[model samples]
Target chain A: MLKLMQNEWMKLWHKKGTWIMVGILVILTAGMMGLMKWISLQNMGGEMTREGMIQDPSSLGGTVLLLTVIVAAGIVASEFSQGTIKMLLTRPVKRWKILVSKFLTVNLFGMFLMLIGYVVYLLLAMLLFKSDAGESLSSWSVWSKSLYMLLLSFGNVFITSTFAFAIGSVFRSSSLAIGLSLFIYFTGSTISALLSQYEIAKYLFFTHMDLTQFETGMMLVPDLTMPFSLAVLAVYIVVFLLISFSTFIKRDVTA
Target chain B: MKPVVELKNLSKTIRSKKIIDNLNLSLYPGQITGFLGPNGAGKTTTIRMMVGLMKQTEGDIVIEGVSLRDNFEEGLSKVGVIVENPEMYKFMSGYKNLLHFARMHKGVTKERIDDVVRQVGMQNRIHEKVGTYSLGMRQRLGLAQALLHRPKFLILDEPTNGLDPAGIREFRQYLRKIAETEGVSVFVSSHMLSEIELMCDRIAIIQNGKLIDIREMSEARESFYYIEATPAEKAKQLLTDGGFTVEPFTDGLLVNAEQHQIPDLVESFIAEGLQVFAVQPHRKTLEDEFLEMTGGGQIAEAYAK
Candidate 1:
């Protein structure tokens, strides 16, 4: 299994699109920080501080999610499109092992991108913004809060990319996976809000997708706890993974 | 000799239609077997099942005495496959592509990879991207990757689909050498009857999802002598009375006779006042036998004579 993941990682980096993705992620993170600095300099908004921006890393989450979704969707679907799936599936390794390795590789790439994006966001925030409330950069309280926000933001990226991966593997089309995943990410919260008064809203995965809502005390559905939301998201992730693995292992691989 | 691979009562059905019937076949070491059939006669489907690309609805495939259903990885570890046009990671170099596959099989070292690369004569271009390779080069790389683990059984589908004459000849010699020196069993499916005739020791014909015939190439075929004589009428009558089932061919009569009896028969025809213009042996080609076996089925570009 470790060998298989090594193989997957090698193939992933060999593509030009992967490097392009990393470049785009860095540029976008910098651009977002620069735009915020410009907004503050124009006296058009309240004072922006490094600590304040560090605690709200959700701005980078959308970019990480998009990049992760692209990788996840293509990791399986591109094999079929490139007609390389035959060579891949005909090896001595079992089908489930191959699928698992690809899944793990996709998440690894997502994490790597997230780390890069956060570092860029941090450096730019410190360089371009001041400490409005005189908050120390090396303080433990600020670091933990920043890290916690990053973790919550990653949760949203993880769930969305898994959904895309499942769709891509089951349908064997990256475009559909990316399109459907982005659609759900953009509209899931609004749909949950529309049905917030109903009991079914609590059971919906969209209601729990953004775990950061618990930190901000902005509950989409009333009386939802962090543990309850985690439980619901766990079930959704398991279902998505089950669908991906079963379909991948049982596929005919005519390509 | 014990067989290296066996297919027992294998069957597949898709959408209420049987794509492959209950089929059985066995492949032995040090032998090269040819698989022949018309399009959609389940040639690709059977190959897919053997390699685990498709599941069989019934029966089991046993390789190296291990059932694929019971344990697929162990059974397939000894097998190597190059399904039609081995699609590789075009972005990576040929060496990396080989390394990628090497990681999938156990005990395939880096030295083994270099050895296979040299074996396929791709040492010069091994470091180049696969996207820059020609079809022949890609075919050689395909063979290189398949042989990286030194498999005991090698399965190739249309192995010579895209190659020059020299490349085809070289590839054929390579397959023959492995089968002989390493005692590897080979299964090749091709639409080119002539290629199969030259490369295979035995041929298996299938039609309508069923195995129709399996024959050894070394088996003696019936000898035929074409005699063209004028006063063709008297010649025909003489051969008809000579206890031979004579069939009328172009400008002559085809007599099913042995080699030693030919001179006497010519002499008898001369005495009957018939002029023997042409008397020579006619060996039946594999194409004729294939057409005859498949009931003149629609062969894809096989009748390009």
Candidate 2:
């Protein structure tokens, strides 16, 4: 099983897209940082502060979600598209093990994107901040709150990415996976807002995905608790995995 | 003969249509066995079942005495295959593709990787990305990856699909060496008969999900002579009277007579006042025999004068 996992990692790393996607995200972060520098130069502001620079890319929750979903969606879908999965399956291992390794590679890539995003945020903030930047962002209370919000956002990103991975596995089309994942990611907050009037909104997986609301005390619906929201996310995770493995294991790869 | 792989009444049905029906075959070690069939003849389907890519509705593939149905991992561990084309991570170097496959099975070391690279004659370009490889090079790399574990059985489905004539010959030589040196049982399927005739020791001909016949090659192949003589009709009659299997050919008669009996045959023809113009070995290629077998065309008569 470990060997199979190792093989999956080898395949993932060998793909130029894996590195390219992360590079694209870093470039995007840099682009955003550049815009910040331009805004600071305009001198139409109170001194541009370090907190504001750090908050720029760090607040890119939707962008991170889109990129991560692409990573997660391409994991299993491209194998089918490229026909490499046939070679993968013919090896001396079970199909389930192969699927597990694919899932592992995708999840790890999601973590990688998060880490890379975090690093890019730090670098851009350090490099682009003005010499006369306002007060340093050193308040421990603000730091703790900021840390909680960022972790919550990243956690939600992982959850939605898994959802995309499942859809990709079922359809075996990366385009469809990316399309629907992005569609859902873009519309989830609006949908949640509309559904907030209904009591059953607390039960929707998308409603609870943005766990940052737990820290902000901004529940989508009345009487929604952190544990309850966590439970809903957990159920979604189980359902996503079940769909991924069941469809992957049972479908015949005729192509 | 020790069997490297055995399929007993194996079957696969997709969408209520039977793709394979009760396929039973035994592939022995140290020889190349050709799987011959026309298009959509269940040749690839059977191979897929053996490799566990497609589940068999009914039957077992026993590789080294392990049942594919009962223990797929163990059964598959003894087998390796390149289905259709050798699809690899095109973005990666050829060396990396082989290395990734090596990690799946135990005991395949760096030495073995280098050995296979050398075996396939891809040492110079092993470091290049697979996307840059020619079709033949990719085929060779595919074969190398299959042989990395020293599997007892190797299955190739339409392996020579896009190779040139020279490339095909080179690939055949590689398979032969693997069968002889590694003692691997090679099950290669193809629609080309001349190819199987040259490479395989025995050929299992399948048509419409059933084994048509198992024909042996070389010493086991049928040998005869094409006897062309004046008064061809009478020559055929005389030969038939002499207890020989004679069929009319466009030029003369095709006589299934042994080489030693040729002198007597010619003498009898001379005695009958017929001029013996041509007497030569009439070797029936696999294509010729298959045409006769499938009733697609007439034999001996089909060949031009």
Please give each candidate's TM-score. 0.97, 0.89
- For model 2 the local lDDT of residue A204 reads 81
| Candidate 1 ranges with C-alpha deviation above 4 Å | B230-234, B299-305
TM-score leader: 1
* TM-score, predicted candidate 2 vs. hidden true structure: 0.89
lDDT of 2 by residue, B48-69 (tens): 7788778888888899999987
Looking at candidate 2 chain A, the ten consecutive residues that score lowest on lDDT are A52-61
Model 2 spans > 4 angstroms off: A1-3, A31-58, A123-140, A217-219, B218-222, B230-232, B297-305
B187-290 per-residue lDDT for model 1 (tens digits): 99999999999999999988889999999999989999998999888887888888888988889988999999998998898787888799999988898888
DockQ for all candidate structures vs. native: 0.88, 0.68
In model 1 chain B, the worst 10-residue window by lDDT is: B296-305
Look at candidate 2 and tell me the lDDT of residue A94: 86
Candidate 2, after superposition: displacement of residue A181 in Å? 0.6
